[model samples]
Target: MHVSSHHQPLLVALSVAVAVFTAYVALDLAGRQRATAGAARWAWLGAAAVAMGGGIWSMHFIAMLALVTPVPVAYDLTITLVSLALPIVVTGGALALTARDGLAWGRLALGGLVMGGGIVLMHYVGMAAITMDGVVTYDPGLVALSALIAVAAATAALRLAGAIRTRAQRAIGAVTMGAAVIGMHFVGMAAATFTFHEGKAQRWFEASPVEAPVLALQVAGVTGIVLALALTSSALARRSAERKAREVEATLAEERQSSETLLRQSEERLRLAVQATGLGTWDWDMARDAILWSERTYALFGLAPGSAVDYTRFLQAVHPDDRAVVEAAVRTALAPEGDGRLEAEFRALQPDGAVRWLSTQGQTHFESGASATGERRPVRLLGTILDITARRLAEERLRASLQEKEMLLREVHHRVKNNMQAITAILQLEAAQVADEKAREGFAAVGQRIQAMARLHEQLYSAQDLRRIDLGSYFAELGQGLAALHVGQPVCIEAAVEPLVCDLDTAMPLGLIANELVTNSLKHAFPDGRSGTVRIRLFREGDDVVFEVSDDGVGSETGERAKGLGKRLIEALAQQVQAQLDINRAGGYRSLFRMPGTRFTAPDAAVAPTETVG
Candidate 1:
C-alpha cells in the first residue's frame, strides 16, 4: 500500500508560513531577553518558549488536519498533550542556558544538542499520537535524515538567537531562525509513512479528523495574536529605554560644558593676577632640560616678547659675581636633603649693559615616572622674579648722604675747638700782662673756663661717636690740667671717674662746674702751702649722675667765699645742667653735683670712691 500525506498544498504552505513567522517572533523575544536582568529576564525567556512551542504544535496540528486518507484519522489525547509539552520544555531550557554571561562554546554546544534532541523527539512523538485503522511505519533512512535535519535546524536557530545583538541583526536572525524551524517540521513530515485498511473506525477519547482542522486553525490564530502582542510590548519597551538614554546623555553634555567654562574663567583670573603684580613666572622641567617663561619674565630680563631661551641662556644673563650664588641656591633647593624652597637676591645684567637687582622665590616639585628608577625626583622648578633695582639705588644714595653729613659735623667740631683755644690763649696772655692780683686771678679763672669747654670739643673730635663724649676720660683730663695749673701747692690730685657717656649739651655745662670747684679748692681750701689731696669723682647714681670734687685741707676762713665770681660761675653751670649741688667743709671742701634724667652706669661703686692718682 502506498503511504503519503493527503494534505492540501495551500493549507500546508499556510501552516508552514505561520510556523516560520512564529519562530521569527520567538527568536526576537529571546534576543531581547538577553538585555533584561533578574526575574524580568526569566519572564521574557518563558514567554519566548511558550510562543515558539505553541507555534510549532499549532503548525503540526494544522498540517495534520490538511491530510486526507481512505480511513478517518484521530489523535490520542494523552500522546498529543505530551507532544505539546516537549517543545515548551526544551525551548525554555535552551533560552535559559544561552542567557548566561560569558556563555562558553562548550556550554552552548551542549545546550544546542539537548534542544535539538527535544525537537526531534517532539516531532516523532506527535506523529505517534495519530490513531487510525492502519499501521504506520517510518522509513529508517528517511527518519534518520529527518531527525538529523531537526537537530541541525534547532542548533542553527539557537546559535543565531544567542549571537544576534543589534535590531537589524535580530531582524535578519529572526528570518533565518524562522526558516530553520519550518524546514525541520517539513522534513520530519516527509519521513513518515502510513498504511491504511479498507474500513477504519475512530476510537473513543480520540480527536475527530474533521473537527481537528478547525481547532488547529483556532490555535494557530491564537498563537499568532499572542506573538503580535509580545512584539508590540518589546517595541514599546525599547523606545522607552532609548528615550531615557538620550536624556542622560544630554545632562552629561551640559555638565561638561559648564565645567569647561568654569575652568577657563579660573585660568583667566590667574593670568590677570600674575600680570598685575609684575611677577615674572618660570617653569623649568628638569628631566626635559627645558624652560618655559611667562611673558612678564622676558620683559624682566630685558628681552622682547616670544624670545626663547634655555637654562644656559638664563644663567648667562645673571651678573658674573652673582651667577655662582644663584646656581648654588637652585641646586640646594633641588637636593634631596633640601626643603624644596628657594630664595635669592642677586643682580642681573641686561642686554643694554644695565644692572638690575632681582629677588626670586621658588619651589621644586618632585614627580615620579619611568625616569629616576621609578622613584620620585625633582622634575620641575617653579619660581617668580621681581625687579629690586630702584630700592637698591635708593638705599645706596641714603648711605652716601649720611657719610657726607658725618664728615661735615666732625669738621665743625674741630673748628669750634681751635677758635675757643685761640680765645683762651688771648685771655692767658692778657693775665700775664695785668699787674693787679684780682685782675690776674679773674683772667686765670676765665681762661680755665674757656679751656674746660675747649676740652669738651677736643673729646668730641677724638671720639668715634661725635654726638657724645666719654665723661670719665674728660673729667680725668680736666682734673690733671687744673692741678698742673695750681703749681705752688704740693697737692695730690686723685680722680675716681667711672665710665660714662653724655651728649655735648650736658658735657659742656658739667665740665665748667667741675672747673670752678677744683680751682676754688686749689686756691683757698689748702692754705699757707699746706700739703693736701683733691679728689674728683664722676659716676652714675640710680637714674642720675654724681660729679663730686673734694679736697683734704684746712677749712676756708668763711663760707662767704662761695659768693664770689667762682661761686657765681659754678651756680650758673649747675643751673644749665639742671643739677643739684651740695657743699661739705667739715673734713675738707666737697662739692657734690647730681643731674637727673641721666641714664649711665659705672662698672664699680660710685658712693664709695675708689681713688686713682693723676
Candidate 2:
C-alpha cells in the first residue's frame, strides 16, 4: 500500500527551530569541555553529547509528529526508549574523540563514521518502534542515500562544533549544523515504506502504545534539562575565569608598586650621598658627542643647570697648564688596550677667572662586539669630579711655613754657638790670669765645659737633621778636647763610642755629665805623675743609654770625691737626665750612668774606639 503524508507547517518550523537551538547548546557545552581538565572534561563531554542527541531526536520526533497519516500512528514503549540511547552514546564517543585542544583528520573521519551510523540507527530503529498493524521497511537505494546524508551531516556538525568559538560564528555554525541534522532526518524519513493490511484501521486510537503528543512532551522535557545544564555550567565557568583574571591583575599591581618604591628610594639615596660628598657626576654619549651632567656637576663647573656640554667644552673649562694632561688621561681610558679606568687631577678655571683644583675619576663603557668595518669602541663614559681647591691651598701654605721654620732653627743654632764661644773666651782669659794653681784649674775646667757646649751648637748647625744630635760623635770629639786640657800628664784617654743618635734636648746634659766624670778621673786618679789609661765608653745596653768612665790608676776614693764640684755636677746631670749612676772602685775607678727611657735613631749603632793622649 502507498501511504501519502505531509508535515504541518508550524510543527515543521518548530522542529527546525528546536534543532538549531539544540546545536547551539551542544556547541556551548563542547567549548566548556575543551577548557576543562581531569574528570570535569569528561563530564562536560557527556553533557554536550546528551544535549546534542536529545535535541536531534526531538527535531526528528517532532517532524514525524507533524506528518498526518490516514491511520492513527503509535510507537512501542521499549523500542522508542531504546532508539533514544543510540544518538546519546554515539555522540558522546564522537565528542570525546574530537572535542579537545586539537583535532586531526583521522579522528574526524572516524568520529564522522560512528556518528553517522548512530544517527541512521536512531531513525530506523525509531521507525521499528511503530505499533500499527502495518509493516515498516525502507527502500535500499533511499536508505543508502539517507546513510550518506547522515555521514555528510555528522562530519559537518563535528567540524562546526570544533571550529565554533565566538558568538557570531557559533550562531552561524548552529544554523548550519541544524540544517545538516534536519536533512539527514528528512532523507531517512523518505526511505521508509509503510505496508498496511485492510484491518490495521481498526486498531487506530484504541489505547495506543505511546501517543505522539505525550512522547513529544517527554522529549521536550529532556531537551530542556540538557539545555539548562549546559547554559548554567557555561555561566559558572565564565565567572570563574573572570575572577582569576582580576586576582592576577591585583597581584601585578601590588608588585609594581613595591618595585617603584624601592627604585625611588635608591635614587634618592644616591642623590643625597652625592650632595654630601660634594661630588659631581656625568655621563657621555660618544656617538652623539653629547654630555649629560647631574645638577651637582653643573654647580662644580660654575655652569647653569640644564646647560648642554661636550668634550670640547670640558677642555675649555680646564686650566691652560693642566688641560693637556687631562685630555691624555681621557684618551687612555677610552683606548682599546686599556682597562677603561681613569684618574686625573687638574685645575678647573671658573667663569670668574679663579682656579679650583679638580680631581676626576671615570670609566668607559665599550661595545661588546665589533662592527663590520671597525673594532669595538667606547659607547659611553661615566665619571665623577670633586673640588680640591681648599686642600691644595692649605698644602702650599704648609710647605712655605715649613721652609721658614727650618731657616729659623738654623739661625738659632748658629747664634747659640757664637754666644758659647764668647763665654769660653772669657773663661780662658780668666783662667790664664789666675795665679793660684787650684783656682786656675777650676777656671780652665769651666772654659773647657763652655767650649764643649760651643762645639755642640756648631755640630748641630751643620748636621743633616736639626732635631737630632749624634751622641757618640759629640762625646768622642769632647774627649779629644778633654785630653788636651792635661798636656804632658802622660795619661791616655781612650773613647769607645757608639754612633747612637738621640734627641737634641739630652745633648747638653749628657755631654756635661761625661765631661765632669772624665775630668775627675784625670785630675786625681793618676796623681804623683803616674800615667794610666782612662776609658770613656758610650753605648746602649738593653733599654738604657750607658756612659762609663774608668781608670787603671789608683782607684779614686768616692768619700773624698763627694766634697768636690765634679761629684755634685755629676749628681745634678744624672738627675736631669733621669740616669742611675753606679760607682765601682774595686778593680779600677769605674763611674757608670744609665739613662732610662732614652730612644736612639738605630737600635744597633756600631761602636769604635777613638784614642787621644794627655
Candidate 3:
C-alpha cells in the first residue's frame, strides 16, 4: 500500500466529512426527542443510524485507499465493521430516549459498557488482521490511549441521551462527541506511527515527529470544528420543527373548542326557538300502537300529566265530524305512495265540549329488526304540532277590512264628484247673470280650481288604493280642464309631465298649481286673436319634485296679474308645500317651483292665477 502526500489531504478531508455527518445524526436525534413521541422518534433514530453507518463505511474505504502501508483486505473489512458499529450504538441510545418507559440509569450504564467493550474488542481484532509488510511494532501506551478514546466517545453519547434538556444542552452534547472523535483520530494516528519501518519505529508523541503530529492535529482540529458546526445546525433545525408542532397543536385545539362552542350555541338557539313558538314534539309508532309526546304536547291536548295517549287516544280527541278526514290523512301517510308520516290540520274536541284546531306533522323511522310475528315493528313517526288559530283569525279580519274600505272609498268618491259637478253648474249659472267681466272671471276661476281638487279624489277612487294618485296624470287632466274653460282664442297648452305617483299630500297642491298656471296662460297669454303656447313640465330631481310653467304672452300688467290674488295664491301654495318658487321673465314669462317630500296643505292668501290680455 502506497500513496502520495496529496492523497493524504483527500483522506483527511473524507474522515472529517464522516465525523461531521455522525455529529449531525446525533444532534438530530437529540433534538427530535422533545418534538416527536411514540413510534416516530424511534423510527427516525433507526434511519439516522443507517445513514451514519454508510458515512462511516465511506470514510473507512477512503482512509484505507490512502494508506502508505499495504493493509490486507481482511483488515480493512474488519476496520469498516468496527467503525459502522459506533453509529449503531448511538442510534439505539436515541431510540431508548423515546420509550414509553425510559431506560433506567443502570440500563444506560450497562448499555454503554457493552458498546465500549465491543469497540475495544473490534479494535484489537482488526489490529491483529493488519500485516505491515516491512514494519512490525506494537506500543502498549498507544493501544491504551486508543481504548480510552473509544470509552470516552461511548460515555459522552450515553450522558447526552440520558439528560438532553434545552437546545443548548444538546449542542454541548454534540461538542462533546466531536471532541471524542478528535481524540480518537489523533490517538489512532499516534498508534500508527509506532509501526516499524525499515527496522525502525518512531514515537509521534515524543514531540519530535513534526509531519505526523501536525497532520494529525490539523485533521483532528478540522474534523472537531466541522462536527460541532453540523451538530449546531441540526439542533437548530429540530428546535424550530418542535416549536412549529406545538403551535399547530395549540391552534387545532383552539379551533376544536371554538367549533364545539358554536355547535352548542346553535343547539340552545334551536331549543329556545321551539319553546317560544308553543310547538309540541310528538313521536308515533304505526305498528306497536305506541305514541310519545313532550309535556307541551300533553298540555296542548288538555290532558293531565302521566296520562297515556296512544294512537287510539289521539284519534278519540278528534271531533266526530273531522274524524274521517284525519283517518284518511293517516291512511295516505302509511300508504306505499306516501312517506310514512302524517301532516294534517283538524279540529280536536276537548272534554269541555270546546273545539280546538291542531296542525300535526311528523316523519317516520324504520326499525332495524322484525318482530316475533315476522313483521317489521311499526315505524316511528316524529314531528311537531303548532296552534295556528290566532293566525287564521287575523287573516280573516284583514280580508274583511280590505273589502269594506274599498267599497266605502268608492262611494265617497262618487258622492264628492257629483257634489263638485253640482257646485260647478251652480257657479256657471250664477256667472251668466254677472254683468261685470271681472266677477265672471272670478267665478269661472273658482269653479275650475274646485274641479282640479275634485279630480285628485276622482283619480284615487279609480286607483287600486284610495290613498295615492298619479301626479302626472292628475296634473295633465287639470291643465286640459283649464284650457277648455277659456273660450276666446283658446290657448295652445302643452303638458310635459313625468310618470310620477304620490300620496294625496303631494297630488292636491300640484293639481291646484297646474290649474292656476293654465288659467293664467290662457286668460292673458293669447289675446286679440293672437294665439300663443303655454308649456307646463313636472319631473322629479333627486329627492325634490319640480314643476315648471312657461307662457309666451303679453308681459305682466302693472298692478294686474303680478300683484293680484293669483300671484299671492302661488306664493302661499309654494310656502305651504315647503317649496321654493322662482319666477323668471327672461323668456316672456316662466315660473318654477321645487318641493321636498309629499307634505302639502292649503295656505293663507293662496291667490288664484290673475288673467291679463296680451
Candidate 2: regions farther than 4 A off: 1-278, 284-291, 304-316, 323-344, 361-383, 437-441, 459-502, 511-614
Order the candidates by TM-score, highest first. 1, 2, 3
Task: List candidate 3 stretches off by more than 4 Å.
Answer: 1-273, 279-389, 487-490, 557-559, 597-614
Which one wins on lDDT?
Answer: 2
Q: What lDDT is reached at residue 28 by model 3?
A: 60
Q: Model 3 clash pairs?
A: 1-70, 287-378, 524-612, 566-608, 569-606, 569-607
Locate the minimum summed-lDDT window of 10 residues in model 3: 605-614
State how far residue 585 of model 2 sits from its true place (Å): 7.0
Note the residue pairs that clash in candidate 1: none
The lDDT, on a scale of 0 to 1, for candidate 3 is 0.64
Per residue, candidate 3 scores C-alpha lDDT tens digits across 48-136 of: 44443334333443443445443222234455466556546654553354333455766666655554554555444444444443343
Give the winner by TM-score: 1 or 3.
1
lDDT of each: 0.79, 0.81, 0.64
What TM value does model 1 have?
0.55
Cα lDDT tens digits, model 1, 398-462, are: 98997787778777778888998999899989989999999998888888988898888887777
Winner by TM-score: 1
* TM-score of each predicted structure versus truth: 0.55, 0.53, 0.45
For residue 328, give model 3's deviation from the true position in Å: 27
lDDT of 1: 0.79
